[model samples]
Target: MEMPKEFESFAEARKNNFLNVKAAKDAGKKVVGTYCTYTPWEIIDAAGAMPISVCSVSDETVEDAEKHLPKNLCPLIKASYGFAITDKCPFIYFADMIVGETTCDGKKKMYELLGEIKNVHVMQLPHRQNDPVALSLWKGEMIKLKEKLEKDFGVVITEEAIKKSIKVKNEQRNLLKEIYSLSKLDPPPISGYEMHKIFDATNFVVDVEAKNNELREMISGLQEVAATGNSPVSKDSKRILITGCPSGGVAEKVVKTVEEVGGVVVCFENCSGIKEKCVNVDETKDVYDALAEKYLSIPCSVMSPNTGRMELLDELIEEYKVDGVIDITLQACHTYAVESFSVKKVCNENKVGFMNLETNYSSSDVGQVRTRLEAFIEML
Candidate 1:
């Protein structure tokens, strides 16, 4: 089959940008949740609940939260808890509860304070993630989340419903995988920025099957405009790889900027990229078993390095013939952020050119960001 399209269009999503916050205001959906890789946001949305992908830095910018939050905390963490600390958190008042997980050091510390916010609930990812202990714990957490959803939104959490939702998520994943595969082709069918719009729009819109259908049409209609001679596809572009956890726009931006500056982003190994994978459920398997499998196999915040995350990235780099690497991490996501120095040093030692760009919210201080990106590109 011809390559399937990436479902979201930059123009369409921009036009409908107001829908997400509007749905929440209309009491149509209860959550604007923050998720790492593979967190069931689609399932939550499928339940007719409004689920906004959480931006960790909004609290500070919107609620004056930076005053109370430790300055060292990642801006996203500060933003998430900004309302609680400063009393201006719109999400705190609007959300039934902010369902959270202790995915990294900054989040873990921030989670403790959320308990004080009255309506917030937190999920502490197990220390031994992906192993038996974590698998069992996550299943229990899903159950608890189901109960919370029902209680908070009055939507019954049925096994059948979750199963249907899983199917939808899988379909979306398949479509995205196809899009990623297209990126890997001899001549990428589109530009890096064009691909980012697709990724971003998927998060905003609904109806997965229809979304994929749209994507298929777009991809089929696409002309194989080779990457700007700057994409990893064009051996001429500076080959670069990026590593980080729980990134969406940030990861995409890293690739976009690199491509913009004659650097080819050969591989992206963030949690949201390839490390966190979703498993298809067998009809014969029990629902719980299927659920466990889904959680256990997901490359999430904790599933780094150990769960083939590190190995998978290593292979992608070698396979893609990456010429350099970029570490995109949040300041508060201590696990990934603190590891930045190591990531850089190792890349240096390995003689792989690399740079680290830290961010709170993906969009912040464009002028400042432009300078840094330009510097990174010049070095290349």
Candidate 2:
């Protein structure tokens, strides 16, 4: 169940292991609330402020939310309302404005909940994702958000500011991408679960440059050792292609499980993993177009007419040279989970060996998971 000594140990957030608004209060960091898909929050951090990704899932009943929010709102909304109903989230409440982006059903309702709160400004994103016009409007919204920050927090947003931020953020994104590429190796230099930790902690840690530099060195060192082929998988490893929902967990876990079962993960087919590299952004064409292009090209859980997912699966088989596929479904994530059967049917027709794994908050079913994975690897 444990990884090699070279890999970092994983830990979850403890009650006092984090800041309860005190970090922002003490640092005089202006807090801003942003619902799902506000990649701009990274921009906000780059602009010299703290952008809190409002998880808001800290409560029970969705009562107080009924006023502005609809009755049948998504879990994320109900959870956010649950937070407000249970206790005052000073971080979000203290925030002067809230930015909402186009993500899914859960995030849309978040905008309505913000209306019920006093002194909370709201920015609405477009329904279509990665659309050229929508991206422009969002960028415009960011401009307005900057204007507001200047007025309220006295922080001026300049071209030099956003452009510099884009570089830093892009560096982080690219570094993560490189880390993902490493998983293609046998016994992979890393695991899918390990990759999740890096992605999740990406925003939590303080020193981005130091951490990234450390990771680059570690991976590079491993690659060097691996240059002569010192990998986990030997000649007996089975290579699998993975496609599923945003592994809210890490993509490395799946890769690791494959290795554990005497298999290898040649490539990933999900958004947070290998799916990201498929996007080649040409910022020179237009910032909005480039941004939209980045998102549009990725293989996502949902697609219109439903051909994208199939195409991605087919290509993954050829590209990764994998023997099978693993589809990860988040607990109660209806949109992604509902499509699982259809995806499985396609995989079967195409003669691709695949399996669906369901999970909750805790990836604690290690024994059961390992058994299932081993069986799949054996079948492949």
Candidate 3:
């Protein structure tokens, strides 16, 4: 049950991460607040600014957010906007610039409102991934973003810097992928809870080298333990695959319910999981084309006819030997909410149990969710 000592630091890093961002800001470092994974971190890094996800995963500020946003909006959007309006999140508060993408109608509109208060720039994200026009538009947006960062930070984002950043970010992705792949083993070496903590804290741990090193060490330790048949998880536990909206706000409710009821989540098909980290940018290609190709390829439900998600789900389900697929859709996230049907179809085709739960960042439905998850896993 023992893990690498670095596991403990991830928790500590999450707690004091804001201070790190504050310190960076105080030291005259430019901080860019990113909402979606589609934002190119390499470009921001190349521009001499630190890119941090400002996505709020709590309902503490949802009420404040609802004051301006509709009461029925997605909690992720509400909480994010709430943090911005209330200046509750240090990442958003210290952000020199907030980079948003038109990933969804809610977020796109939210960015418009957010711009009224903060320095916000919205990228016109193309939803059609395979369309040539979409890639061109995305590439153009990447250049615009690069230009915006340069203009704001007074630094040129040279091609050389971007290439270097692409390598660095790719390295981080590969490390994370290796860590997550550890779950592919029977009786995964790490618990789903522990794995979630490591994955969630990735953005908070800004020191890429330290983060990568910690992951490498964790991987080594985990492989050793797994090889010795000393896994923290039970071999007979139901292997679950979570696919849906970002799970950060709802992980405590969902992941806990699964593990507490004799299930182990081996794959996360959502952004909080492997959705963004699974693919690496092609270093040989032009920086803009590579960024466009890699990001646009992400299988978020925002894309029209998101067949990629189904393919990814199929792959992960087979790879992890999933017993059930839990599609967690946030309230009013119409894209994922509606896309759940297709996800269920995919699960059925793969002969896996499928359960779609539409909820929000509120604990009010925790009991109900747990009851349903218990029934679902029991059925599985």
Best by lDDT: 3
TM-score of model 2 relative to the true fold?
0.71
Candidate 1: Cα lDDT at 279: 47
lDDT order of candidates, top first:
3, 1, 2
How would you encode candidate 2's per-residue C-alpha lDDT over 211-240 as one tens digit per residue?
Answer: 678778866876885687766456567767
Relative to the unseen true structure, what is the C-alpha lDDT of residue 340 in candidate 2, on a scale of 0 to 100? 84
User: Where is the poorest 10-residue window by lDDT in model 1?
Assistant: 1-10
TM-score of each: 0.77, 0.71, 0.96
Q: Number of the top candidate by TM-score?
A: 3
Ordered by TM-score, highest first, the candidates read: 3, 1, 2
After superposition, which runs of candidate 2 have C-alpha atoms over 4 Å from their true positions?
A: 1-25, 33-38, 52-98, 114-152, 232-237, 249-268, 276-289, 292-299, 302-313, 345-350, 362-375
Ranking 2 against 3 by lDDT, winner: 3
Per-residue lDDT of model 3, residues 1-380, tens digit only: 12223324334555488767767777788999988889999999998888898858999889999899999999999999998887667778778899999988998899999999999999999999999999999999999999999888899889999999999889989988998999999989988888888888887656776788888898899999999999989998999999899899988999977999989999888998899998899999999999999999999999998999999998899999999999999999999989998998999999999999999999999999999999998998
